[model samples]
Target: MTVKRHDGRKADEIRPMTAKVGVVPNADGSAMFSFGKTVAIAAVYGPRHLHPQFMQNPSTGILRVNYDLLSFSVAERKKPGPSRRSKEISKVTEWALAPAVNLEEFPNTVVDVEIYILQADASTRVAGINAAAMALAHAGIPMKTLVSAVAAGKLDKELIVDVDKEEEDFREGEGATDFPAAKLSGRDEFSLLQLDGKIQPELVPKALEMISSACEKVYEVQKKALKDFIENPEGGNGK
Candidate 1:
């Protein structure tokens, strides 16, 4: 196992995290979350009636997520607006938070979540998920529990809690395995799991254990941000 990370974090340690709510006053609800240098902002609009009458769900309200990585967010700037990658991640994010939300009470309606990466080092999608989860709650959506997420995997021969850009680019030893996962904070339930690299089957359990633990820490931060916003809606930017 590698003894030290390039940024000096222990294998199981995460970079400092920052979370806040009410970042966008115009939106019904909004939040921002960052993992070290990677930052994401999310805004929630609606519970409004579904348009296009044919598409409305009588059984429950539907969630529509639009995720985007700003053109200047990375060194290799992407084209502006939604791309295939953003669309796919948006769908995965919807699936991640859907289970925690109780939408039956608002059938035939829609909840739109807009997420943008203001800056990205690595783990942008997971950061977007974290921000979006808080925005949903701030919008007054009833939820069973908050959802938290992280990208945890193997960095060479070592296990890591949260993968950063340097670790993501590692091309030595066993290489890197980027596994982004999400879970409901108050329960032992996984909401999403996507692996971008290979790993031995025997190591799966250990990786999952690490991911679960990291998410709890993320959840604590998310929970605190929400409570802080409730107590003092005018302010809540924290680390």
Candidate 2:
């Protein structure tokens, strides 16, 4: 069965994307990123002193991430405080971004990344991760490379890139699944890989390949956003 996306994109195509840096003046670095209707804003603070109690490694900086979904971010209003799912997402996001950052350079300090989802469709975490990466770069944090992420899944027996909310519903349930993957730009190593729902073991490799190519495209958009912000800090469009 042939499956067509409502947005008119090809199976391998990603959604329309836009990103901008320096969204929050008070934050050391900030970015607003959107993939179609899903929007996420990320703020980076610190590389500053960490309290004595929380300092786990005296020789390396600590990276912390907080992921939040606004009460009105979805069709049904979400709760105000962090839920268990949010906490897990925060942990994975932190890990996903840590590989790109030079944490050892600022020992006894912390780099805090906060990501807020103002709107959601699907692939919200991926959007948030991409935003957080841009925010870190904006803050002048040393890094190996920026991170880019994308979600791909099997829908109606066909592989699709950047799943939207409707496709994610998977009501028909024909081997549907959500595979979210993230990797450092220009690198083959994966920083995050998550699978939800069912997919044949044989297809896993193909799914990873699709997602990797999608991330490379996302990486180009991320680079453009950072470049634009650096060249036009005062006239940035993120606000």
Candidate 3:
């Protein structure tokens, strides 16, 4: 099986990433991210009130994430209903972002992180995760670790990084399962893991390795955005 490559990039190459903070005024803080053809936005709201019954811990603040895909993000228009996929993503997002926030200070309040995918090519979840981290940091949310996500897939027996939609289809086929592939499967190492096709256990480690490298690159972008936000309270461009 022959695999197509993007711009001759290496198997672990991440797309050009950019993060911008304070894009939304309504929210306490916000960030936008561009990962190749993928686009994601994240907004943070409140250490505000939470229903008494829903409170998980009165000693710490709550972390919640809401994820949504725009109707026009893909070829098909998505319905305006909650999807299990989004729920799963939200859960992982909350986990990945939780570590960064010092929830103990807020007690009964809750912080909400909202993620919207405007465009998706591949690695939308990872992009969304990264965006959420940036938004929280922009909001001055105290966190321990800066989390990020990315994916690796096998195409025609070749393990490639940042698999786009076309490559994803090829990787999902019956024969694709036999090839080596990897994914981010931990909240500590990665924010989320979702796989539609098959992957060998050995490949899982490789995927984590690639994801670690990618996350560092993304973290740099996040730091830059947060730094700019602080330096130029007016605008990143200093307008």
Strongest candidate by lDDT: 2
Please provide, for model 3 over 35-149, each residue's C-alpha lDDT reduced to its tens digit, 9 standing for 90 to 100. 7898999999977787665675779989889988988898889886669988877887777667557989888888889999999886787788878887887777777766666
Q: Write the per-residue lDDT of candidate 2 for residues 53-125, one digit (tens) a residue.
A: 5665788999999998999999999989999999999999998999999989888889999999999998999
Clash totals for all candidate models: 0, 0, 2
The C-alpha stretches of model 2 lying farther than 4 A from their native spots are: 173-175, 237-239
Q: Candidate 3: deviation at residue 87, Å?
A: 1.6
lDDT of 2: 0.90
Error of 1 at 171 (Å): 0.5
What TM-score do all the candidates reach, one by one? 0.96, 0.96, 0.86
Candidate with the larger lDDT of 1 and 2: 2
Show where candidate 3 strays beyond 4 Å.
Answer: 1-3, 171-188, 236-239
Two-way lDDT contest, 2 vs 3, winner: 2
Candidate 1 lowest-lDDT run of ten: 230-239
Sort by lDDT, best first: what order?
2, 1, 3
Which pairs of residues collide in model 2? Answer: none
